[model samples]
Structures are given as structure tokens and as C-alpha cells.
Target: MRYGEATVTVVDPRSYMTYQPFLPEAAAGSISPRHVVVPLRRVLPKAEVLTGRVTTIDQDRKVATIAPLVGEAYELPFDYLVIAMGAVSRTFPIPGLAEQGIGMKGIEEAIGLRNHVLEQLDKADSTNDEEVRRKALTFVFVGGGFAGAETIGEVEDMARDAAKYYTNVSREDMRFILVDAADKILPEVGPKLGAYGKEHLESRGVEVYLSTSMDSCVDGHVVLKNGLEVDSSTIVWTAGVKPNPVLSRFGLPLGPRGHVDTQATLQVQGTDYIWAAGDNAQVPDVAARKAGVENAWCPPNAQHALRQARVLGDNVISGMRGFPQKEYAHANKGAVAGLGLHKGVAMIVMGKMKIKLKGRLAWYMHRSYHGFAMPTWNRKIRVFADWTLAVFLKREVVSLGAIETPREEFYEAAKPAPKVAQSAEAQLPPTRAKSEEKAKAS
Candidate 1:
């Protein structure tokens, strides 16, 4: 049943290779977006990595109907399937969200956010209109998790630096807000570190709203559940993510949160061939079981995902060749997050010891760890080059919003004419008529 190198199809809707740990750095201009993402094709050269959304699956026939980016949907048969489709940004049905706020999920969003922030600064500087300037200078970020906290921090740092170059705009005029429903931020790094992060952000003039949720962001007018109202132009939504709902359509058993149910060996429950990993699978935490927990599942993070992927790959080979499969188990390997340049927090769990770091040292550790963890040598060099060049050259602040619609301007400039040109057929030549009559007589 096994094909050569095995036809392993990793179904991720987004084709970009996301080294998510560097997203903050990318947003902050510390690293380039090009450096943060690797092409999935280059990495998974052997496997048939299909970049498309899975509309539905027939588990009995082992065929998945996929809708690719272009063209029509088609059915692909597979002997073994791996579900690593990952999670999508989660947003509640808040009024005006669709009209305004941007979510930080993929590279496009990150780059768009960076450009929008810089463009806001430009707008503030170019216009003497006080109302427009005020609106342009205000930035609001919802959710206090790693994405929200880090994105706002990096953006604030960039904006502050950029203000120095602008004659009219000053850092004092710009307002930044961080809103979260939870009382604390960065829960993965523990409570004490979360408190430290909040303080660090507040020290930089960011208004922190705890135990508050956004009611609406209609027409750039923000209404919070705490009865506060503010009119701002930029709103960022980083309010966590749920598993891709496509799993439910497959007719497979899904967990409470819509993740596929998988055994400790990373194989789908009751199936011999199918395997799941990454953010999409609810893999049992055997370590938690040994520690007397009733039922615990692996948390969805890159640290766990990378390890699970290796185990899943090995398990596929083992299952096909009649070798023993190993159970996937790993203890939490701490967490590190950069608040801004030279400011970060870290908690390392080594054996029985739990070591924590903060400030510049933690920042260094954050960069160092992620630098080594980025996919390949080519990406590692590009990231380092970005850092090296950043020391001498300023971060590119121009926003190519037009990149999405490059042809719009050209099409408008070259409008089509309504009338057609006159041809020789419109004037029946006398010589041609005579020649046709002579031929008919002959």
C-alpha cells in the first residue's frame, strides 16, 4: 500500500511556511517577512504538498475533495492522510468588525498591518486637519495574548522611532491601547511574567484594559464593554484561534473544540493509516496521564507541533513497514516572548528546575532560540542578513497597499473606446465589383 517516498499530502490552505515565533519580529521591522516564511514547496520537496482548502472527505473511499486556489475542485485519493491544516483567527460576531479591524494570522496580515501603521503616521504628518490627525494617530489592539502584545509593542517601537523623522507628528500625540477580556496577558508565560509584561507596555504609554471586551468598532468608533468610547482608525484583532472547522465536514470523530481525535501515537483513533498532528489534532498527553491527570491533551504551539510532526512521519513509515510505532510525549519546554527591542520574558523548564528571565537577557534568548528553530540554512542566513542590514539601514516604511491591485491604476488610465474603425469593406470598390461580374459571366 506504500508508494515510493509515500504520497504524503500536507493540506494547509495557506501555502506559506510559517515560522510563527518570528512574526513579532517581522511586524516590528526587526526581521523581514521574507525571512519569516519559507516556501512549503522547498521544504516538502518529496511530499505532494497540496495548497488548498479541503471541502469534504470520504473516509471510507479515502478520497478528499479539495478546492484549490484556482480552477475547479477535484478528488485526490490517498493511502495515508495527515491533517495539519492548523487554526484560523477567531473573531466573535461583533458589529462593524468586518468593516474595520484587521486580524494578525498570516504573512499578508502582518505586512498589511505594518504598512497600515506606517501609513497612519504619514497621514498624521501630511494633514493639518486636527480631527483627521487625531484619528490617524490612535491605534487600538484587542486581545492581550502573545500576538496582540508583541505586535503592539513592535509597532509602537517603530512608530516612536518614525515620529522623530516627522516634523508635525510626535510620539506624545500617538495613542496606543491594549484590550483583553482576561485579567492577565501572555498566560503561557505564567502570571508573574504576564504582570511584568503589562507593566512594561504601560511604561511605554500603552493603555491596558483588563477584564474588558470590545462591544463594537463600527466606523472607527470603538465601544468597549466597560462603557468606554473612543474613535480611532486602526484596530487589530488577535483574539486567539480555533481549529479549522473543515474537520467537522470529514465525518470523522472530532473533539469538543472541533479538533480531530488522535491516539498518543499520532494516529487517528480506530484507523490504522490516517495520522494527524499540529494544531488540528487532539493528541493525548501521556506525560499528563502519568502524573495522575484524568485526561489532558497537547496544547497547540510550534514547540509541540514540530515534535509531533517528526513522530507522525516516523509512525507513518513504521505502520507501512510493520515496525513498532513510538508514542509521542513531551513536557512543556517553557515559553519566551519579546515585548520590544531589548525587553522580553522567558520561562525554561529543565528537568526539575524552572528558570525564568526578563528584560534584555530574555530578549536575546528569544531571538537566539527562534533563529536556530527557523526551518533551513537558507532562511537562517536571510534572517541574519535582515538583522545585520537593519543596523545600518532604516526599516522600509513605505506601504504597498496597491500591491494587491496593481492593474487598477493602469486600467483606469487606459480606458477602452466604444466605436470600431472603418474598413475597405464599408466602401464597395467599383473595380472589385466589375471583376466579380466578369468572373460570373465567364
Candidate 2:
């Protein structure tokens, strides 16, 4: 209510906004699935929330089309539009990827992955066939960024714990492979920390493949360009993300890379009424610009997105009234990545002094930063509680994979039996047909 006269509406496909940084913990069962998300309605009580996909935006008419989950499409008009729809996972034309590969983008995927990994263990333990067991034990991950590295790290940790309960399966039997075309992993933490992360995974028996590419994974047979082939039941793809494709549908000026073009003030270029931010907007790196660097753009990460959202919101309010809009400008504080429980890396920049940290201390730092940064007090308390409980309890490794297809058993049991042909007389009540025939004869 800063302006007191303006109304805001938030339209998104999901009712809640997912905090993606904790996806690895969720997948590893270190955190509850529900704790990683903030319900938009709960957080944005002043704004109107529309749970649906925005198919098209007609800026000329100031109306956009919304396709809801269980209703006909409708048009919504607005005086100003903010395109912060964010980005989606970028994938190439690799065969069988869409069919076989699991992603680590949302809460559902994290839960599904946890269940899937545990289910694979169950299968390996129960199976008698050597090939089946081998396939079930093999896990392949594409991409070595924060999503890929932390995911494999946390998941491997969880799997090792689960193996203690399995009779036939052990951590030795499970193969974890992380493949990336880049020469190093965790590039955000600089070279030293990235190499440390790689060595750490290697020490844990994870096969880290650098300067390699997956050729194809047709029918679960992963073929790499480096002449390595493996049959893995679990294939995770976390390569990277591109701007949301829906941006093209909106008649707005987009950058060469498909992000909506926006000025330093977070206002869409060439238009005063439109504003955009986050991954979908090509925001200028204000810190870089001040250092006399040319062609600098903000990196698409949680840190930037969170800050940009606040700045964008303020700019929107200022733009509505006749107030000067503040330009978004902030120097990089640092970067942090958690690798499973007590392992992590961090870089903190304070003026000219640069501090690098690794191992358990860095892990604690990572948790503290993100715990407070998590949107609402409700989520912060829940996340903190999960971390506090982890000190005394082990990670839960149970799988509910059946949740994906819950109605399968019901469908099988409730299936209609084969129809049998019955004579017309057999359809009649007992003796009714005979009485009717006798009456006809009389």
C-alpha cells in the first residue's frame, strides 16, 4: 500500500513460488518438500493472484490472455505490465532426453527424484538379473553447475545412508557419473574452489567427466562423444536454463538472447508503462558498468533475481506516481555452494579484500545466508527447524514413487471384465418371460 491507489495482480502457472536453491536438500530428503515453497496468496495478500499460464499479451490493448487449470480462457487488462516470468530449463535435441531424463527445477521434481533413487535401490536389491541390477545402480547426471553438483552430492549422500538398510545393494554398487562439457565444475566459486569440488566428488567415487558431451541417450543407453557408453535407469539433466518461451508471445522488445530488453531502471526499453526484471530481463550489471566495463549483464542467479524483484516492485510504484525511479545497482557480495551435509565452498568480497572458505564452515555459512534470505518468516522457521533436527536425526531415504501413478492399482482392479452375450429371455425376471409366453398362447 505504498501508493494506496494502485492494485497489483500476479499471474503464474504455479500457485506458489519455489525457492530453487534448496532443491538438492529436498531431493536428498534433508528438508521437507513443502518448506521450499512460498504460497503467493499468503505472501502477496494485497495483490490479486491468478493461478494459470499467460498465453498471450496484447500490449496495445493493455489486455492479456490467461489459460487457467480448469476453466475457459479470459482476458485481464492492466495499466502496467511487469514481465518477471523467469526462465525454463534449456535442452538440446538429444534423443530420449525428454523421455528418460529427470530435472531438478521444482519441488515436485525433487520429491520425484528422491523417490526414484530409493526405488532404484529397491529394484536393485530385489532383482536377480545382473544386467537389471547394474542398470538400476547406474546414475548419470548432465551439467556440473550448482544444480547438478549439489544434487549429485546430496543424492549420493542419501543413497549411501539408504544402502546400510539394503541387503544386496551397497554404496560400492552404485555408480554416480557427472558429465559436463566445461573443463571445470562450480565456476561461480572461482577455479580453486571449483577444482576442490571436483576432487571432493572424485574422492567420494563420483566419476567427473570434463570436456565431454553426451551424444545421445536413446532407449536409456547413454552414448557419449568421448566413446563412453552406459546403461543407466536414472538420467538427470540440469544443463542450464533459457528465458521463458512465453516472452516471445508478448509483443515486447527482447534482447538477442530472448530476454525482454530493459534499461538500468528495470523499465522495458522504448516504453514507459512496461517493466521487466529477473532472468527474463537482460539487466545491466551496474557494478560492472561503474568499473568501465562494456557490454556487462547481470548473471541469472537467485541473488540477482531476489534483489531485482524488490527493485522492480519499487520502480513500479514510483513509475505509477510521478516519482523518480531508482536504478538497480549492487556490487557482488560473493557466491556459496553446498555439497551435501558438511561440505561447501564460499567466496566473500569486501572492498578489495577477497575471502575464500571451504569445507564445514562454508557449509554453515551457506545455510545461514539462505535461511535468512528465504521469503517469509514461516519458511525461515521451517527451514531452520529442519536444519536443527538434522543435527540429531539422519536424512530420510524412503521412496514414495507410487505417488506419481497413484491410480494405477485402482485402474487395474477396477478394469471392466470381458462382456458376455445373453439371450433376450435371460434378461427378463424369473418366470416373467414364461408367464408372458403363456398369456400370448391363451
Candidate 3:
């Protein structure tokens, strides 16, 4: 019998889902936000996709406790389970981070942030107070990794282009600061490429502070550990991510970083009926093996996650019907990053040869790779069309800040009831008094 026929369900918390590689471009306005996200139901048509947070997993009974989006908690039973819940954004116990900073993780956050940035520019342009304008113009981004770096690059590029339309706001008056505890940015790429990316961003007037960390962002006045202080309205935090803590309740084997331990075949260790992949599993990377080393694991990235999912799907099917499973062995293809519109850095490994490219070539390579890697043809065409049209037409500068309250304007206009004119019969004054006066005159 098929797994779906024998009771199998996949639980994902968020409603807005996607492959996630196109997030940077979506934030940069290169691709529409709608094109970047794919519905979970469409992709996993066979499996039941439950929209809720998995609070607990009981491996002993092969059951998972899920809290539904609107209903009460319920138990789901399965013969075989796939744990691909993914990671959560990591945040420190900073004083005011929760109050002031925003994160880039899901599609909603990306779209909200894009609108928020443009709205800030509009607010700055209309305000006459210098203090308020400076605060509105200043943007602080914490973390120097891919999320932080790419996000800041795209937002800055869009903001710079947008400033031309604003009468008061100029690119020079606006401030963009990037803060990271590490000495370098984009460490996923090699050191040379990382250095190139930093220099490229700096040349574009982005103030990058290395070996520094954010101390506090209380009341929107950012304080850095490097003794630097800046008052800004916008703060983004994208330092890193930690595995979901709910896995610990499953009573299964877990690795040092709290990720589920899995074998090379993508099956969870000590369990034949369960499988895990993506950012939630620590599957041994046979390709990264050294001559003397016993086992090595691959890092979490879209490249690895996509391949791992395929292997996991096949292995699950094979196991359900009594067949031999295959081991996953794949080498890293290299890394590419877009700095802004026409600038990027890449390091590609083609067999034994390693090649590096920068500037416009790298930017084109980044777009081409991601364009083909996007989930479906429907999305790929939409993304390409958005970019193709962008070349000739100016970027859309309007911010629909009231997108959430789309009906508010109409509701306000319809609030008061219309006034009606009274008929002459209803308006006749004191008929009884007039009749009494006429009787006295008679």
C-alpha cells in the first residue's frame, strides 16, 4: 500500500513557503514576491500537508503532536515519517532586539521589509525635522553572512534608485551599516571571494564593521560593542540559525547541534521507518571524506537540501516496498552571490579546476544559475519576465503599506448614513394646537 493510503502527513508551520533561493532577488525587486513562493500543497500532492507547528514527536509510538493553525492539538499516526521541518532564525538575548530588529526568513517578512524600507523613504521625504529624517534614512543590518549581506545589498540598491524620485532624500544623506562579529563576510565562499565581496560592497558606500557585534538597539538607538553608536529606524538581524528544539522531545538520536542524526542513505539512525533531510538532518557527507577521516557531513544549503530531498524520497519509496536503497554521494558545485544589480562574486569548482569571477559576469552567473534552479517552469518564466521588463521600465517605487488593511479606506468612506429630506405632511407643526385655536375662534 502507498504511504499516503496508510496514514502519512507532513507538517510545516508557515503558510508562505518556497524553495528559498530566490529570496534575495525577491527583496531586491528583481522578481515579484508571488513568483518566489510555491504552495506546499501543490508540490506534495500525494502527502497530506498539515499547516501547523509540530510541538512534540513521540518516536516510540510513531506519533507526532501537532498544534493546528486554528484548532486544538491533535495526534497524527504514520507508518513512515519524514522530518523536514527546517531551521529557525537565531537571536541572542540582546536588550531591545525583539522590539527593534526584524529578520528575513519567510516570504511575508521579505515583502513586509521591502514595503517598510520604501515607506521609510517616503516618511523621510515628507518630514521637515532633521532628526526624524536621519532616523528614517539610517538602516542598520546585523550579521555578515549570506542573509544579512545579500539583503542589505539588494535593499540598498533599490533604495538608491528610489532616492532619485524623492526631493529631499539623497543617497549621500542615507546611511547603511553592516555589523558582524566575524572578521569577514560570506564565509561560505572561500576567503578570497569573501574579501572581494566585502570590498565591492564598501566601494558602493556601505559601511561594513568587522569583528564587531551589536550591544543593544534600545529605542532605535543602536549601540555596537566596537564603541560605535548610531540612531536609526531600521534594524535587521540575520546572524545565523539553530535547529528546531522540538526534535529533542522525539527521544531519538540527535547530533551536537541538535540536528537529527541520519545515515548516508538519508534514513534516521536507529529507525528504519523514519527519514530526515534539509536543515533538520545531519547526514554524513561521503564526498567530503578525507583520506584518513571516517565520516564527514555536508553543510546546510539549498544545493545540498534539494539533492538530499530527492534521495530521501527515493529511499522512502524503496523501503516501503522491499528494495535496495542507494547512497547519496555528491560534491559541492561552488557558491555565487549577487552584491547588487551589476556586481557579484563567485567561486566555481569544475572537476579539478577552480575558477573565480567578479563584477558583471558573476552577477549574470548568479541569476542564470538561480533562474534554472528555481522550483517550477511557471515560477522561472515569471521571474525572468520581471527582470526583462525591469530593464526598459523604471522600478515600481510605490509602497502599498496598507496592503494588510485593503478595505480600511472603503470602510471609512461608508461610515456615516445618508440624510433624507422630510415630506411636507411629516413636517406640519402642531396640528392639535392649530385645531384648538380654530375651535376657540369659532
Scored by TM-score, the top model is 2
Model 3 Cα lDDT, one tens digit per residue, 175-285: 999999999999988889899889888988999999999999999999999999999889998898878888898877899989999999988888899888989889888
What residue pairs are clashing in model 1? none
lDDT of 1 by residue, 387-416 (tens): 789878987666677776889999988989
lDDT of 2 by residue, 1-442 (tens): 4556878889998999999999999999888999999999999988899989899988789999999998899999999889988888989999999999999888999999999999999999999999999999999999999999999999999999999999999999999999999999999989999999999999999999999989899888999878999999999999988999888888889999999999999999998889988889999999989989899999899888888889988988888777898899878889999999899999998987879999999998999999999999999999999989998987777899889999999999999987998988889987899898899999
Error of 2 at 435 (Å): 12
> Candidate 3, which segments miss by more than 4 Å at Cα?
1-8, 291-295, 407-442
Backbone collision tally, model 1? 0
Clashing pairs in 2: none
Candidate 3 has what TM-score?
A: 0.90
Ranking by lDDT: 2, 1, 3
Q: Count the backbone clashes (under 3 Å) in each candidate.
A: 0, 0, 0
For residue 419, what is the lDDT in candidate 2? 93
Q: Look at candidate 2 and tell me the lDDT of residue 188.
A: 90
Please list the Cα RMSD from the true structure of every candidate, rounded to 1 decimal place: 5.4, 3.0, 4.1
Per-model CA lDDT versus the true structure: 0.88, 0.92, 0.86
